[model samples]
Target: MITDMTQGNPTKTIIKFAFPFLVGNLFQQLYNIVDSVVVGRFIGTDALAAVGSSFMIMNFFSFVIIGLCMGSSAVYSFFFGKKDYVSLRKSVFISFFSIGIFTIVLSILIILNTNNMLLLIKTPQSILEGSQDYLEIIFGGLIFVFLFNACSALIRSVGDSKTPLYFLILSAAINIVLDLVFVVEFNMNVEGVAIATVIAQAVSSILCFIYAFIKIPLIRLHREDMVFDREISTMVAKYSILTSLQQSIMTFGMVCVQGIVNTFGPDTIAAFTAAGKIDSIAYLPVQDFGNAFSTYIAQNKGAKNNERIHEGVKSAARTIIVFCLVLSTLIFINSENLMRIFVKANESNVINLGVEYLTIISVFYMLIGFLFMFYGYFRGIGALNISLVLTVISLGTRVLMAYVLSSIPTLGQRGIWWSVPLGWALADSVGLIIYKRLK
Candidate 1:
């Protein structure tokens, strides 16, 4: 289904598109959210800490795949909009196989050194083996994760968001069932959770691929459409490499931040783990909105609908602001209730510290809302270099300030929470200035 998003009511189109995207993101995150809840309640905070500790490392690799998908989607959406089916087919061929090969190689390399990777992150001794168990299974299934992500993004890029949402609902449902069976019935421990995730991803990727080839005429490749185009490949690589670098920088900084959090003792680890889970849920809608905005902008840009892009983005900003204000406020007021969902009842220190962390971070939701929109706009229009610079600024400030403030005798772990808002403030301000300057 090739949708020309260039001609609709901009606000209604974005709203219609972003709603399914948001639902898909929620289903997508069920993988992590379920993993955290199951680990915390059934296996204890040590196991939850293990999963949380390894999360950023997992995200760094996910960054590589997502970056390429984002880059390819921007180009392909433009092609789809302009009815350039030949080049669109070529982009599809290259993106699918190239990402598949890269992820396979990356999985092998990471699987070979999973233990050492955990050690490098200063994974606490109590949770080290659990982390190792989780990372190995996930890395081994990297091909499925990478492929599913790319395929889903491709589907949405052409304005087929509901299809992916359906695929994800089935996938998330399977993962939840398998999580219970593996963890409780089979007694695979933490390894079970990872295996469940991998299996679910494999199923989703296969189904999604089958559906696309059979159902979407645009995805079907003809013999003439299979040739490699060096010029297009170069353009995609240019956007993807810089985009990947931008995300890699941010995740790498989080790994460093994770390492720093490890030094603050197991209490901090448990609290941060719980807080991180809440943060993921809270941020998901905005992230989904940003992704939709990117595709919307790219499709319109391809049609030379500059004024439409501007009008749509303005409406989106208003919606996102309302969303942010409402969510942050709810989280702030009920921060303790939410913390209790992940941290066990006996861990009062973890609950208190989790509240502190969430309370501090939720206050800056408005900044993050703006930052995501700007990132999407830049990525969609091929202004990826600016996006890259903004990411570096955000991550650099976060890591530096975390170490600086946390080292203070008075601040202790509290400073780490404070550093988040401050870093977000700086990055959002920079992103706004950049957005204003963009023509």
Candidate 2:
């Protein structure tokens, strides 16, 4: 199950490793996408709007955990490539304890202030109670989120991407079934979807943990492995905190934009939500490919295979460009139909708004594609700060442009749509320049 990236053609190896990641992430996105569809169709527009808006907040916290796990996974890949089992074991121990504690503290704070947090985001009064209830239930599953991400990261670090995919497929199926049961059959509404998500997350986390302990010897910890080494801890903190900050900042920017979207009322919110999910699913292949590329680069870097790393950069670029172009064309052509899947066909206003957003954003998928490649490359090379800087540039531009352009009488919400690609173009430019200099 463990494939070595240090051997084989750069393109083939990276693609093979990345395919499972792409599939797994799709299933993962289904957790949110299914929630939105179920609520929007069965419940009502306001319910859909509440779930959609709440997603911005939930995504922020979820990315924090993802970033931490991703950062630590880079460390694991490096150690594994170096064949330093001792250091790998130590890192596994350090990251698990450190991120675990952080998740607990964060969950407590967020749960305690759920209502206040919703108010701060300027959630509309009509959807405020629903958002609060949804978030509160979702937050209760943070530990499960932490556990699942941590275990999967450790497993994938050693090049076993397929194992994680298996678990995610199972969990996603469970989530879909539960969503129907709770929301449609039992009529639990927004709260029903929230509970289903948490339960699904718990199932995946528990199964992933058991698999890691039984199957991945490198992840198994002895009592002696639990002892903290200051050196390893510092390295772990550097990768985890910086990556977490980068991810949190990026999502925080979305949270700000969500506040702006909230001002436009429930229709816009519902449309934006559906469009955003489709956008995420559309571009996810490239994103997951970037992550897989990172692991490939990390392992090569660890093995001192600089030549392979360089080759990988080129291979990844070509793959991303082709994939993004094809995906963009598909989404642009099918925007309206995709929207109808989430919103009712009779809800022409919501579908049309979502279609407009998609058409505007789809053509620029390559820009974000290139940006993700740069992010993965930087993270792989331990240039965590560079990744963080690129994120700030992209998301900062997004938040700023979104506010300024949207305020224009002529531009309005279209400005928000236009701002996304502008941010992507800016970040891609900077990333390409930096990579050139580094080369």
Rate residue 79 of model 2 by lDDT: 92
lDDT of 2: 0.93
Question: How many residue pairs clash in each candidate at the backbone level?
Answer: 0, 0
Span of 10 residues, lowest total lDDT, candidate 2: 215-224
Estimate the lDDT of model 1.
0.84
Return the clash pairs for model 1, or none.
none
Deviating ranges (above 4 Å) for candidate 2: none
Write model 2 residue lDDT over 294-400, tens digit each, in one string.
99999999999999999999999999889988999999899988999999988999998999999999999999889889989999999999999999999999999
lDDT of 2 at 153: 91
| Clash-forming residue pairs, model 2 | none
Model 1 per-residue lDDT at 174: 95
Name the lDDT value of residue 76 in candidate 1: 83
